[model samples]
Target: MNRFLRTLCVLVMLAVVAPALAATDVEAVKQRVAKVDVLRGEFTQEKQVAGFKNPLRSQGRFVLAQDHGVIWTTLKPFPSEVVVTRDRILSRQSDGSSRVELDGRQQPAMRSVNAIMFALMSGDAQALSAQFTVKVEVLPGNGWKMQLTPRSAMLGKVFAQLTLSGDRYVREVQINEANQDVTRIQFAGMSDTPTTLSTDEGRRFE
Candidate 1:
């Protein structure tokens, strides 16, 4: 697959797993993520594909708005942006040219992907449980980890497993694909302050 398609697949994998956690632990995570109406963070992603001597790496900043959806901007390796909402997926190049845009009304898969992204990021247990069989582990210091196995045979053909770890927000996401490729993403410098998105920043979603 090309770089952009590969990256897109990785994004979809962000919510690929839904494991079982204690009810209290699950509620705690849901509550923690619920406090944020908007979230901004920096991320580093590494993909280890079989037969590649070195892993592909990229760095980016992301914005998640409760109603506006997600704006992910990649700054390293190459500049690109992906804006995903309930109704559409917009991809743009560094030159401010549109690369691809998918409307959910025309493409039902886009809607499904968008929903999965939101559910995964927001820690919505009900939505996740609909897709994957999940197992969650409580860690020391109020942190938690989760492992997800695909409940659908179709999903199992594409992914082997997915794991997520975090405290108040998702700190890491790991995807093990059926092809033996693995992608790991680490998020840092997260902020959920009301001022996190300025007027200019907010316009990116438009």
Candidate 2:
């Protein structure tokens, strides 16, 4: 299909799906999730690549400080850390040296990368609505599941869909890429106590 036709198709699909989305209280789910200002948890991610027989797996612990940023420490396969903040994404080696992977000072659009990660981890549905047509399903025991489909031709070329579900906090996220690859992440051992960051963890943000 031509580019024009593809664009038209997406517009038509949104026109049909918009009403049902409006009727759902997805904002409430966002509010519930946003209550946590600080949280720490362990995460396991599996990435299934196209044509690859085995999926790549990694285990990590994460600290989400709404005031600062997120710290993802990968402990297995390779020891490293990725810090996603409002200004840049910092990558650190196991030995403690780190570098800025994407700096918004050099490229303003790099901020979008920051926004996307914060919105996803912080459950800011309104932020995601800018790029995706989202559908929210309320689950038993106050849980909720959301599926996001790309809204633009550019994003549609990269992501087929993204599904996320959680109760008091986000529990899992599954991403479907346009190339038939899939990535799934699950969270466990979440806690909000001991709100203060450790000295070492605090230095990572510097």
Candidate 3:
């Protein structure tokens, strides 16, 4: 389930609201998402496997630094953290010990996944456009919706479709896997204040 949790898009703290969209397009949604330098927030995730009747659930918090990378710490059911950067991915336990590490330079798939993770967390429409066939819709209540289909061979292996729905800030991300599994991630008690990383966060980036 932890490996499947990698597909979750966590930490969407959009405190700065934008004007209602005059146009319903990826560009418009991109403009609405808060462009903060640092964002910290809590998240809840649900993983529904095809054969299982009950979904597996977990909640966690994440720190996203646009200039650096993202640190995701899962707190329930298990305690571990996955840190994502441009060049590599580092997964560790709550004890600050390494569990898994991958270099983008060594694995082609890792490079693609890293790019997509940053793109999704930061609401980078341009980056997403480059990789997925994107469709956008204007919800009746003023929220926006998006459907993304993988355009790459590597992505097609893990994901079938990705749905994003939110207003001002993305509120939920639903992942549809190729193997009939689904994962939904929602943020709670989210805020975009304190636009600076803490000392421990800074050290983790090293």
What lDDT score belongs to each candidate, Candidate 1 first? Answer: 0.69, 0.64, 0.66
- The lDDT of model 3 is 0.66
Instruction: Provide the global lDDT of candidate 1 against the true structure.
Output: 0.69
Q: For all the candidates, what are their Cα RMSDs to the real structure?
A: 3.7, 8.4, 4.6
Candidate 2, residue 32: the lDDT equals: 49
- What alpha-carbon RMSD in Å does predicted model 2 have with respect to the real structure? 8.4
Error (Å) of candidate 1 at residue 33 is: 4.9
* Count of steric clashes across candidates, in order: 6, 0, 0
Query: Which 10-residue window of candidate 1 scores lowest in summed lDDT?
Result: 15-24
Candidate 1's residue-wise lDDT over 1-206, tens digit each? 33444456456445222212322235655544435667778889998988998999989888777667777888999998887777877788966776787677886554665576566656575676777887777787878787878776645655689888887767888888877889999988987787456897778777
Tens digits of per-residue lDDT, candidate 2, 88-187, equal: 6667687777553656577544465455545554555466677778787887787888888878676677569877778776787777777787878788
Regions of candidate 2 where Cα sits further than 4 Å from its true position:
1-34, 97-100, 119-126
Best by lDDT: 1
Q: TM-score for all predictions?
A: 0.82, 0.77, 0.82
The best-first sequence of candidates by lDDT reads 1, 3, 2
What is the Cα-based TM-score of model 1? 0.82
